[model samples]
Target: MLSYNSLSLYLQVVINLTLLTGLILLVRNGIKTMEVIMLFLSGEFALELTDLVDRLLKLNTLNTYNYALSQFLGLVMLTEIYSRYFLKVPAFVKWIIYGYAMIFLVINIMDIYHRAPVTFYSNIISSIIICSFAAAYCVKILQKGKVEKSLFIVNTFVFLFFLLNA
Candidate 1:
């Protein structure tokens, strides 16, 4: 019989694989925005798979590396998706987001080398930034007086959940 932790890991693998399949299908048939979102989901799936492998192999420190890489890439992808799809922000704002993402990526890379422990700081920073982006998107949609109710509601709740879970 599988232990609880092993069962959880197996469940996560299954969920991520399902999400990966849906994302792949959406990317094949959807718009440009779907491409960015697909990349984000793909990264997530890859990291989860890495986690499963690490668990099965009893690897040393692979989770830290996988997590750091995922956080950085997730932030970059989220910035792109939010700026392009969720917000009607100016180009300068998008550039600023990209700049921040680049800086965060560098910090994470440094953390991967210098920090012996897991990069919780980088994860927290990325989570907060993503949550802020979702909040800002909601505010923008409200201000614009024509809300894409589904997008606004779904993304807002998702990011809030991300923040709390983070």
Candidate 2:
């Protein structure tokens, strides 16, 4: 019988593969904003794939720093994705977003390497920012009052995922 972790890992693999297939189909539709999201998902898939291998080989330490890297990269790409696709942030806002991302990455790395106690700050900040952006997107669509059914479903799923995770 497979353990819970094994089941979860297999489930994640299936989800990632589905995402990859969806991305491929979306690429053919020529939605340029999805390119960043596609890249992020691809990176996420690679990380999870390596994690599956690590579990099989008992090489846990091989992914010690990878979680932090993936989180930071996700934050960075989500910022770009939201700014470009959902909201048109001003230039200065973009600068601040990038600056915060850099600081978040640096603090995350330092905390990991130095065993600093302030590591959670980066995680909290990133979560809050991303959640806020997701909320803003939801609000914007709601105000429009004519969102397509497919978009509404997708938006709800994305918002709920971040909200629950955050």
Candidate 3:
């Protein structure tokens, strides 16, 4: 029987493969949002693959950095997705997103310099931010009473995933 750690690694690999396949299909079909999703998936897959390799090789040095970087990138990508989805959102909302991103970056940099493991805080903050964006999108859809089926599906999944993870 596989150990828990081994099983999780296998699961991650499966997920990465699935994401890669979906990304390829999206690219081929030339979806308008393909570029954003493509970049996000590509970064995520690369980071995940690196992490898997690092674990298998037992090179544990960069694990914290890898995790932190992945979380940061995930937040940025999700923000971009939501910003595009809610194009009519107020100017202040965009400013808030920008401000939060800057603060997050500063926190990550300070943590790295001080050799502090800050993934927990970063993860929580990012999750909340992402969930907020997803929720806002959902509200907008409801108010409009017309849904972009694809975006609604994506937003729903993102909201649930981040909410649970948070």
Candidate 4:
């Protein structure tokens, strides 16, 4: 007796998980920085894992909190990893990013548990964050002079879908 909405969301989760996995495998043979890219890919996979968990089970307040926190953490880690491809960020900056995201994650967990709504505009705000990361990923592809056109388009498209659904 699955509802259409939940089924659709789960399907999207599966789709994203597949794409991320494929991209990770495609880049696995690249030299030098392949290991780092693989690490971020695994981080991306974590999002799918949490999304599946939230969608399959009866989600309570704690479950919702964890779901949001997973998205928050996943975006932060993936973006920080991606920033390496675009910007010449310092090592200290990475630590700072992790620290800031952890702080926000804790606050968000509390907010979700307390039924305190988010202050950062809306869920659309997180969508914007994802879009921005996708942009950064595009820049990396461009810098490398690779034809990552499909990846770029699909990333933006998927982010927009989530944004609208949010």
Model 3 agreement with the true structure over 97-157: per-residue lDDT tens digits: 7677667666775676554446567678788888888877878877889987666755765
lDDT tens string, model 1, 1-166? 8897777577757656665665665566554545667667777778877877886787737875675677667777777777777876678866776776677666666665566343666567668878988888777777888886446644754485456536
Candidate 1 lDDT (Cα, 0 to 1): 0.68
The lDDT values for all models are 0.68, 0.65, 0.70, 0.58
Ranked by lDDT, top first? 3, 1, 2, 4
TM-score of model 2 (CA atoms) = 0.70
Candidate 4: segments with Cα more than 4 A from true spot: 1-8, 27-32, 59-62, 89-100, 113-116, 119-123, 136-166
What is candidate 4's CA lDDT for residue 166? 56
In candidate 3, what residue range of length 10 has the lowest lDDT sum? 113-122
Where does model 1 exceed 4 Å of error?
1-33, 89-118, 157-161
Candidate closest to the true structure, highest TM-score = 3
lDDT comparing candidate 2 with the true structure:
0.65
TM-score-superior candidate, 1 or 3:
3
Q: Which regions of candidate 3 deviate over 4 angstroms? A: 1-11, 14-18, 21-25, 87-92, 95-99, 102-117
lDDT (Cα, tens digit) per residue for candidate 4, span 52-134: 66666755565566656665655565555556544455677666656766666666767764544662533555556656666
TM-scores for every predicted model = 0.67, 0.70, 0.73, 0.59
